[model samples]
Target: MSEIPVTPLLDTVDTPSDLRKLDQSQLRQLADELRAEMISAVGTTGGHLGSGLGVVELTTAIHYVFDTPRDRVIWDVGHQAYPHKILTGRRSRIRTLRQGGGLSGFTKRSESEYDPFGAAHSSTSISAALGFAVANKIAGKPGKAIAVIGDGAMSAGMAYEAMNNAEQAGNRLIVILNDNDMSIAPPVGGLSSYLARIVSSREFLSIRELARKLARKLPKALHSAARKTDSFARGMAMGGTLFEELGFYYVGPIDGHDLEHLIPVLENVRDAAEGPCLIHVVTTKGKGYGPAEESADKYHGVQKFDVITGAQAKAPPGPPSYTSVFAKALIAEGERDPTICAITAAMPGGTGVDSFGAAFPDRSFDVGIAEQHAVTFAAGLAAQGMRPFCAIYSTFLQRAYDQVVHDVAIQNLPVRFAIDRAGLVGADGATHAGSFDVTYLASLPNFVVMAAADEAELVNMVHTCAMHDSGPIAVRYPRGNGTGVALPEVPELLEIGKGRIVRQGKKVAILSLGTRLAEALKAADILDAKGLSTTVADLRFAKPLDVELIRKLLISHEVAVTVEEASIGGLGAHVLTMASDEGLIDGGLKLRTLRLPDVFQDHDKPELQYKEAGLDAESIVETVLKALRMNSVGVVEEVRA
Candidate 1:
């Protein structure tokens, strides 16, 4: 790792309060060092790179001006918190970020004194900051509360709702609208354009000042009417008059990158602001870095890379990732079927739909971060006799749970969900883990949930969902590269609710779900060498489980084990429920469920996390042997292939 040049101003500053002591010129130099440190650290750790780099100056300015420990600053979506973390007494631990037992990638309340409110999901900062502001008021403590939210985050309905409530409350709050013109992808919908128009309007200030002066000089009774007229005039000229109507004192269109502009604007707002104010600060997404500025979205989050070349370190060549496999399968399916279409919520590239979008531009839709709209939009398309595949991350899909239940499931819409990142996602931590989708979707009516055990199975599942026209179907796959299994030339759809027994044995049976099949196979081999033959079955569908196969296994085997990569309420829980409902446990067959525990697992390498959770080959072997009441076998004992 290349050593970051330690500047005198940055060296003494261990926390935000320490940063407050530095002069503006020194702070500017510190900002440069912070950016360099962030780029270098992320180049080594491989995390959300560009967002943090963009916010280096903003973060430094905020910490310098604000009271910090007393004055709460909430960051929306938390992706831009790397610099904040580094400045807030975590400089030494910067390299350990997103690693297991290390500093989290996002704003974590437990990690530092300065991070008063933790956030990962978008459009939540305003609401959280308002809550803190209200509490401060109640406590009779005079303190400033600021919410630094992105233009992309402003699209969510929750942000509007919070703004409405904050306006009604008339609390002293500052909302910094970070107008970066992009989220993970280029922002979508009418709001994005409206914001752009309002921010870019050159004549807003001169007109607003004249109107305000005229309103203030009006008679007391006519003041309200004059203010309304001023608002109407502004509305006709600029689009953000809707925000003015919401009762906030709207300010800015200031240059967020220019320190001279930002410093004075922020100071003025801080000194004179009484009610909730929205400062629209325009900033470049990837401000400092040349390559990042050129391709902001591509550099939003990156793997370990060369700082000079901006090229990611070469990874070992292997089988295609599950995401790539799904994308290819969907594209092939779409080519075969004219009605088939694909949709993603601002994540076409992340979801591997870039290829699909290229092949069928008209058929593909990038809906932005509005997950609620994306699900219902897919439903609307499905209602019109179109086969819509809503490709979304499992973590992000949780945002549209209500929509999924109401619009898709209750109506029984044929929307195929290609749920990527359906397991422990390393580095991004708990906020991005694909842990709860299985549990949430399984409980919903008319929802068919399936997990892929490998790349081939994922392809098969995608093909199956595309072919099925009955109801809503979801096929979830994990992050990272797949098992090195050769894919079938022609994709084949498997029978719905039918599971295949991969390995047959005499005494005990292990029923696996998702991509943990290989681990189960390894466990079975380990057991077989110890004179305990184990049967392994891959339960394909979680919703309409193969009861007959399960019953047969329960009757034939003395012990049954259910394994999955999901949380407590997932595949294992469903199996236990089925056993209870069928009264299968009356036969005295011991059942053990192995899945992710209730507590949130820290960010670690997927294999390491699996081993830690006792879901790896060795752990699975140990679990099975212990369940069978067998002695610990020697590690050197080899099983016949």
Candidate 2:
């Protein structure tokens, strides 16, 4: 393997205190070095790229000015914290960016003292910062709390709520609105237009200054009228007048890229700030780099790539990804049915719906990081005799759980949920893993839950959700490529609450759920070679489980094993509930459950993580064999391979 490159300036700096020692000119150099290091690191590790590059100078300025560890600096969403991590004593281990046992891709409070409040989701920084500000006030501490949030994050309702509450509290707080004109996807909605008006009006600052000066110099008797006139004119010139009404002292829409403009404005805001303050800084996404500037969204989160050609490291040829399979199936179904429409919260490309959006522009909706709004919007469409598919990642869907239960489940709307990343995500750590959706969604009253055995089954699930108008239906799938199966020309909907036994044997029966069917098949093969015949059945639906088929297997086979990709309170737990309710345990049928452990799994290769969790084929076979041996079935000395 080639040796890693060295970073000199990055190596020398360990903390924000070390950054404070550098002069303004050296700080500029440090910003350049930081950007280069970020690009280089992401080129190897494949994570968020453009946002970090855009915020390089801003990050440097903040660390240089603020006394961090004393004055808390919170990053909203934290996808842009790569530069912050490199400068804060973590440069040496930067290569292991999102790997297991390595540095987190986002800010983690447990990782370092510099990260006071950790965040992986968006629009949370302002709320967290406000909490710190309130706590500091109660403790009588002389500390400043600043929240650096992107323009896109500011559109969320929670952010506005924090701003309103912070203004009412009358506490000293700073909010830096980084206007980059991009989220993971380009920002949508009315807030985006308001920000655009502020950026386009170049002469807003000079005009506001002249009006303020004129208003102050007026006669004492007519001062109130003069102040009102100034406020009206200022509102007309700069578009941030709405913020003033909310009780926040509104500052500039300044040039963020220019250090000369940013440094002095920030210094003034830090010194003169009393109540809540908002400093609007305009910056370009992927500011300095040519390639990233041209394709900001493509580079938002990436894999290892060649810097010169900007080509990502190629994976060995595999089957179509689970996302592509779903997209293709949805498009096929859309062609057949005109009433079907698709919606995504902020992830069109990530959810593989970009092609569908292009083909059916009028039918697709990109709702922009608002999962709750997306679900309710889908519910509205479903109420009007339209079939709506709301495709979102499992982790992000957690944000809208209440909406799903109230708007969709309670109403029994026929909104189709296409949940992506339904298992252990390889990187991005615990915050991004899709482990809890099964347990959480199953608890809701009127919902149908299903999981695909493979890529071909995922296609059928899409067709099933599109056709089923009985109630809300959800299909969960994993990340990465599929099993290279030949796809069917037409999708066929399977019977609901029914399961198929793939391999029938006499001794033991293995019932698997979702993507873990392949592991069960492998374990069956291992047991077969040992003269211990194993039956494998795919329990397609988790909510309304095939109770009849499970009872038949328990009666015919001596031992039964339940396997699932979720945690303890998931499919396996539901099976145990069924057995206890049906009084199947009194029949002398031995049962063992294999699932992801209760604790959170750290970042690692997906295969290695499964092995460690004892959910792999070898581990499953070992677990089942041990159970059989303990039940007085003679232990096999060796399985014939």
Best by TM-score: 1
State TM-scores per candidate.
0.92, 0.91
Runs off by more than 4 Å, candidate 1: 169-171, 182-225, 232-239, 634-641
lDDT of 2 by residue, 332-353 (tens): 8899999999999788998987
lDDT of 2: 0.82
lDDT of 1 by residue, 1-641 (tens): 44566666678889887887777878778888888888888887888887888888888888887788788899999889999988988889998878878888889888887888888888999999888888887778988889999948888888988988996334458888887874322333444434433432345444655667777788976888887776776555443586787777665555566665566556666665346777776677777888888988888888887787788776888888888999899999999999999999878988988889999999999977789999999999999999999999999999999999999999999999999999898877788899999999998888899999999999899899999899999999999889989898988889989999999998879899999999999988888887778999998888789999998998889778898999888888888899999898877778998888778887887788888777877777777666666558734344458
Pairs in steric clash, model 2: 46-302, 46-303, 100-603
Please list all clashing residue pairs in model 1, or write none if there are none.
Answer: none
Q: How close is candidate 2 to the true structure, as a TM-score?
A: 0.91
In angstroms, what RMSD does candidate 1 have relative to the true structure? 5.1
